[model samples]
Target: MSVEGKAKEAAGYVKEELYEHGKPPESQKKAQEGRDLRNEGRVEDGKPPKTTKPGTSH
Candidate 1:
């Protein structure tokens, strides 16, 4: 993943860690944005976007 995408994902993780009682919607949104950016980068490199797992949503 690109550096900005990685940083966003890491920030989301840290937010989740700091608010363990309940996950905030903003954190989830940030992580999803990271995933989207990573997929966009992959497509720019002529690769398919990463597939989500069978039981997961992305």
Candidate 2:
């Protein structure tokens, strides 16, 4: 393959890896939203939000 083709192939691999295993964990924004819903007793399932640790998967 040409240099450009090889570079594109490598980039494709990187994109696939990132898609399969997402980037590093961030804040619990989604969990917080769930908590807010729980606090308001508006949760769909009437369940509290699941807690998440920093740098850990939800």
- Cα lDDT listed for each candidate: 0.55, 0.39
Writing each residue's lDDT as its tens digit, candidate 1 over 11-31 gives: 544553444333777756655
lDDT of 2 by residue, 1-58 (tens): 2454444444543443344333434323433443343333322334343344422555
Instruction: Assess candidate 1 and give its TM-score to the true structure.
Output: 0.53
Looking at model 1, the pairs that clash are none
Clashing pairs for predicted structure model 2, backbone only: none
Best by lDDT: 1
**Model 2 RMSD vs true structure:** 16.7
RMSD per model, one decimal: 5.7, 16.7
Candidate whose TM-score is highest: 1
Model 1: lDDT to the true structure: 0.55
